[model samples]
Target: METGTLYIIGTPIGNLEDITPRAIRILNEVDVVFCEDTRVTRRLFERHGITTHLKSLNARTESLKIAEVLDLLKEGQSVAYVSDAGTPTVSDPGSQLVGSVRNEGIKIEVIPGPSALTAALSITGVPASEFLFLGFLPHKKGRQTQLKEIAQTKRTVVLYESTHRIIKLLNELEEHIGERKVCIARELTKIYEEVLCGTPLELRGILENDPQKQKGEFVVVISQ
Candidate 1:
């Protein structure tokens, strides 16, 4: 039997309507859907009224499950891989599975959709002719090293930061980059979506005064 194809589907980051028609069709037609979190994907599926079978495929068990997924493909079962949000393998997981499937000589296709990084960059009006996406900074060890590396980059830099460490990261950036222009995109595509632009020091003061502004995931953009 001919090997089945692997579809890397991209889902919406926040707003459900952001999903494209092609993505919904593929989701409904695929024999099985592999996602980082089945529970999260289930919400999307339920919202769209899609009832396709879903299997959990994340960094934790990707190695153990790749063989099984490959086996299913060998049996001519079409499968789709999706992350909890946005495109799969963009700091989410599933790169190993894609590599292993390609090694097996099976076909793979990417179905692009909403990405928080691109969405944040586009709306921020920050020049992104050349930019670096440092997915998530190290939590402890080498954290300073990572910040220093970002500081040296001549082009714009984008990073994903959690609510807990955003203030600390801003302080570090201010210290190393010295009042560089910065943009913070928080709760993107949702009801509370906010885009704040200012120097690192300025943003720090504003966030410090309004503690509520510090809540939710943050996308930090720094201009060189």
Candidate 2:
């Protein structure tokens, strides 16, 4: 049997309109799709009228689903893997599955699309020719150490933060980074998309007084 290919497809981070035509085509053409959330992918599929079969392969079930994906590939069935949002393996699950498939000499293809990391950086105006992308920082344990390192690092640093902890993270940045220039991009590609540029303290004050700005995912870019 011919070896089936694995398509690492990137989907929209926020706005559905950000999805590329090729991504939609691959989603429609693939035999099966392994996604972080079946419900989320289903909504995307439904939006584009794609009826591809989707199975969950999030962090919780990534290990358990690897064998199933391998079995399908071995049977000459192409599979597409996608994160809940944006590109796979960008602080999302897909690395283990891709690594397992690669070891067996299976074909792997990447369908690029929207990524919050790049999206935030695009408007950051910070020289990001060489920068460190921390993705999401640790909630505890090494969190302090990581913050300390970020504070000392000279390179532009980018990280993702959740709505709930964004204010706390901003405060932490103010403590460690000490008035460093920070840019927060929230709800990228969405109708309410916003990018706030200022020192950690200034942005914290904005988010603190305005409850609405506290909502939605955040991409933080700290300049050197």
Candidate 3:
């Protein structure tokens, strides 16, 4: 029996309109959509008029729920996995599922769409052909070592930062990475979206003054 395809789909990070038509079509046709948050993904599907059944496959449940995915694929069912925002497996869930699917020799495909990493890069004006993506820096242990590494690198660096830790990250960057050309993209593609460009000290000062600007997810670019 021929195995079915497992699609790792990339959804929008903010604005729903950013999603591709191809991604929409796949989501509509897939037998099931496994995602980080059913509530979040459902809104996207609803906006696109997609009615595919959604199954929860977040970090907590992915290991236990992945069997359902593998079983469906073995039965020749097409499956799609999406995160709450952006692409799956990039600072998101689905790594384990993808690894397991590959081990089973099941067909896996990527429907590339919106990603915070690319979104920030396109507007950062840093213009680097190559850059190291750290995803999210460690919250505790090994964090300082990684910061040191970032400080020393001559290449562009990109990473995600949460709203709560945005200030902390900027301070750490100031301490370790020193002053460099930093671009902070907040709430990309949304109504409140804005990008701030400056050195770590400059950006940190700006953020500290305007408490409102510190809100929302951030994609930071530190130019070489």
Candidate 4:
């Protein structure tokens, strides 16, 4: 019997139209789909008219359910793994499962699609020949240490910030990197999508004055 293949699919970050046709076909072709949030992924599948059943798989539940994935793969079942948004395994839950499948010599295919990191970078106009990508800062512990590091790094820096912490993150960026040019992108590919360019202090004021601007996923790009 042929060994089953594991598909690492990249779903849209915001707009459902961002998903590639190949990604859509694979999601439908796979025997099962595992994602970060079924409710969120369901919207994407529903938008594309895909009826594949979704199973919950995230950072918290990865360990508990990875064995189940392995068992299915060993049984020659083609499986697909996706994140709540963007590509899988970039600050998502597919790292362990991908590695596990690779160690067992199972086939793995990456279905390239949307990525927030690349989306923000494309619109930032910041020189990113090479840049440091810090996915998300630690909420409390060592947060300052990371900020300090960001202050000194010569390369461009990219970081993801949530709506709730955007203000706090901007304050830290201002405190540490003072006057460094920063580009903030929110709601990529969505109706309210916006890209703001200014110093952290300046952008913070903009977000504060307009409550609507501070209400989505954010990608912060710092110039060298």
TM-score of each: 0.97, 0.98, 0.97, 0.98
- Residues 98-216, model 4: lDDT tens digits: 99899999999999999999999999899988999998999989888889999999999999999999999999999899999999999999999999999999999999999999999
Please give, for residues 1-224, the per-residue lDDT of candidate 3 as tens digits.
88899999998898989888889999989899898988998899889899999989999998998898999999999999999999899998899999999999999999998889998999889966999999899999999999999999999999899999999999999898776889999999999999999988999899999999999999999999
| Residue 203 error, candidate 4, Å | 0.9
In angstroms, the error of model 1 at 51 is: 0.2
lDDT of 2 by residue, 26-113 (tens): 8899999999989998989888999999888999889998999999999999999999899999999999999999999999999999
| Cα-based lDDT for every prediction | 0.92, 0.93, 0.92, 0.93
Ranking of predictions according to TM-score: 2, 4, 3, 1
Q: What's the alpha carbon RMSD for model 4?
A: 0.9
**What's the lDDT for candidate 1?**
0.92
Higher lDDT: candidate 2 or 3?
A: 2
Error of 2 at 175 (Å): 1.0
lDDT of 1 by residue, 73-110 (tens): 99999999999889888878989999999999999988
How high a TM-score does candidate 2 get? 0.98
Ten contiguous residues minimizing lDDT sum, candidate 1: 84-93
- The residue-level lDDT of candidate 4 at 211 comes to 98
User: Once superposed on the true structure, which residue ranges of model 2 sit more than 4 Å away at CA?
Assistant: none
Residue pairs with colliding backbones in model 3 are none
